[model samples]
Target chain A: MEAPATNNQIPGELGIWLFVAGDLIVFSVFFILIALGQKENADIFVQSRGKLDLWVGVLNTLLLLTASWFVAIAVERCRTGLGATASRYFSLGILCGVGFVANKSLEWGSKITQGINPATNEFFMYFFVFTGIHLLHVLVGIGVLCLLRSVSRSPGLNERRIRTLESGATFWHLVDLLWVVLFALLYLL
Target chain B: MLPFFYMGVFAWSGTFCYRVSLGTWFAWVMLLIYYVVKAIDRVEQEETASAQGQRYALTSCAGLLRNLAHAFGWENELKEKNVDPLFRKSMVFCAWSGLIAIVLFIIGGVILGEMLPPLLRANDPPEEFVRKVNEHLLSIRIGSVFLMLSFALFGPFGAGIAALTRRAEKSPVFSYVQLVFTSCGTLVAVLVAFTWALMAFRPDVYHPTTVQMFADFAYFLAVFSVPVFGGWCVVIALPILLAEEGQECFPRWVGYVNLWAVLLFAPGQLVLFFKEGPFSWHGIVALWIPFVAFFLWILIMCLSMLKAVKADDQVTGP
Candidate 1:
């Protein structure tokens, strides 16, 4: 079947759109709940937000945003039949993902050592659960990117394989978008 | 005199309380209302359709009457219409498993388990444990019975999912594997419930250490054996994700939800080491969060099954 029409006619199978939309809705609900919780415990939420490492959040945000850009560029290169260059972009994207994971682990490990955890308060609970779920998405996205990278390196890349790669890249972009929202909600706000 | 009796018991064994939590009982009430309303709706729709059949003279009203008969528990009169018998049966099985068995599980797992939380924990005195078990003896037994029934019901529930999934498979290998994993998952859940029940059976009669052993059995079965169910999740998700576009049993999103459920369930494995944190059995991350995800998974699968049933009915109209 032909791909579904996306914004600017995005390159991906139509089914990935459904998956992306569904995932966004789930995350939206989580964000709404976190917002409601912050309302209930404004003092605790504010204090807890202060305890979060802003620099780490900023670094992770930058990493994911850069990864998203690289993925977008890789998709563009694929469209232009630049497979070798696209593989390089995909590798960069994967490297950024690794950085995000490593940085997130260090941040979590520091907080845990400080004895600040989800059980400390409602705010921290939301912090851990929301970011924890987002981290899972990021990890899955990294795997998808690896698969896309393998496809890029393959000699017999067809239209179907390209669409699959594009679909995986779209999902990586989604992971980045969710992290941006999470960073803002959990840290800046 | 009653006050003195309580005082004496407490003085001898300390204050050990075992009673269902208010939240659990509240959830059970909500589930009951949901199923009751659904059953009513089903009956009403069947009645309306039967009337319409009589009015149209397009088909005999007897078929519709048979549906009503089936709803009222007269299975013999409920002849299979043109719909695929497996799909129809699966729908019915899922409904009962969700509505009845799940309600039972809430009573057994959530309510009763909460009442005796220390029973599942590794650190607790034998006397204190027996005291607590005896305190809520009746509810624990009833809850155990319900949990066992729920576990038994999951067998067909899994088979129903397998049936729905088989539609997209060129070979039924994955479907059979799903069936097997779902049954094994059900068995593990049942074993967990059984251990809890066994502990409550004669708490005072058995040695306190043995009772603690039973608790260990329950917790280990409940917490550590989750990957079996996780395997089922993968089996369920892979088929739907890989199914031919229009031929998928449910939407692709359901497959992703299954994958998310698998992810959500992963934290339960942490119960092995962290006995007190969020990864603990009583903790939000390990127990409550996964339970909520599982509930949503069932809810989505329920809708998917109904969708399958409707599509089948249309394809094989009576």
Candidate 2:
């Protein structure tokens, strides 16, 4: 109750790392299960996909991929010393994140409205679980990008800070990459 | 697979040190996964000039939260920077301690339950009593989940704290101080709800009625009232922990957000009042100021990661 003796630095990087790692592990389990679950429950999984508006998934992936491209350009600019120019590209990526979230909301809304309940089947379970968690990660990614922008404006943006920024770039790409894999697994495979 | 098999064996091995069985042993495996991801992120930092490498790292979900900012919408002002070994090492130590806490916790759970007198334990033993003996530990069971969850939270939470701390001491950014304050207040509000709402209803064992749960939650919120919400706004709106590591991030005021959260929540520490009041009114009311503020801190952290990603991209670009 007495603030847990945490003075801004008690747990530190390892602490943050553990939290994110644990979360990722949980997500990984889900991802792994989804992939494996599909192998075992093919018919239902396909049926669930049939219910999915693939166009939305495809569009979302394309948009995110493009945004990742912009971010890539932005980071390259940073490497070349065009700080502000790179920031613009980063902004474009952030917009993509917001756009992705919006598209996802639409997808979710339509599905929920259609009465595609979570308890329907293993397929729906995987559908909801996979997309839902991914969406949350994407949302988190969006929030992180926003924070980076504000921090960029401040004096704290230094070389070390740049390294941290680099980490964010990698994480975003990861989100995009994972979704691509997910898309292929769910829609194509 | 072997580990999973071992887990089955270890879970029931409470008589033999449980921490040694799970926490300490598997902890290395878990921690290794952590450090490797970070190491990979550091390597990716070098390849930012390359599109593929940038994609590889960013898409992998491994890296400092700042990397997330670059991937999102923030400006890439903060570049690759280092922290003091003291701070970095301290953070690493925090991770080690967190892991140790987990290990010790399991062992503690085992010891308190199996080794203790029968009077302390419950009359009802669970089905998986052998594998899940900790379920029998009356004292440690109360917070085992909290402890484990908190331990897990350490990695990211610690990193965020360390990053912000360095921003405060070294960076000239001023607005961060105020941001930290707002974040802390939000955390206070969340904690208030969590403590009161979570405590009032022990997840109904039977088919839990949603209305009953909602009623309890609503009652808690009403009892805690708007003063706490106002407190949350004040705490979060302050721009306390605004210090930045570079030119593009945040103001210096953001640095104080978490500090203010700790301050706001300090009132709830008054144990006697919290215990005596109805609905745990005093306890819940006390957390009102700090809970929401803390929520803001978390939000700021996520946002900063995204911003840093953007800034990273900008700096990497030519």
The 10-residue segment of model 1 chain B with minimum total lDDT is B14-23
lDDT tens per residue, model 1, B69-177: 8889876433333346765766767755755555666666666654223344444566766776788788778878777886777777787788778766767878999
TM-score of each: 0.66, 0.46
Model 2, A1-189: lDDT tens per residue?
Answer: 576554422111222333344345444655666777788888898878888988998999998999889877766666566666666787889999999999989988998899986557777755765676578669878876776665454453445456556656666776797788778876777
Where is model 1 chain A poorest over a 10-residue stretch in terms of lDDT?
Answer: A6-15
Docking tier of model 1: it is: incorrect
Q: Give fnat, all candidates.
A: 0.12, 0.00
Q: Candidate 2 on B1-318: residue-level lDDT in tens?
A: 576556556655655764345434434444444455446445434333343443565446545576777778553444434323454444445444434544443343223322111111111232222222324434334433443343344344434444544453554332344345334533542343343233223333322343233323433442344344334334333333222322323322233333333333333333222322211322222333333333334444444444443443465551
Give the per-residue lDDT of model 1 (tens digit) for A130-178: 7887898899999999989988988766665777887898899989899
lDDT scores for all predictions? 0.73, 0.49
Point out where model 1 deviates above 4 Å: A1-58, A73-88, A101-136, A149-170, A177-189, B1-87, B110-128, B207-210
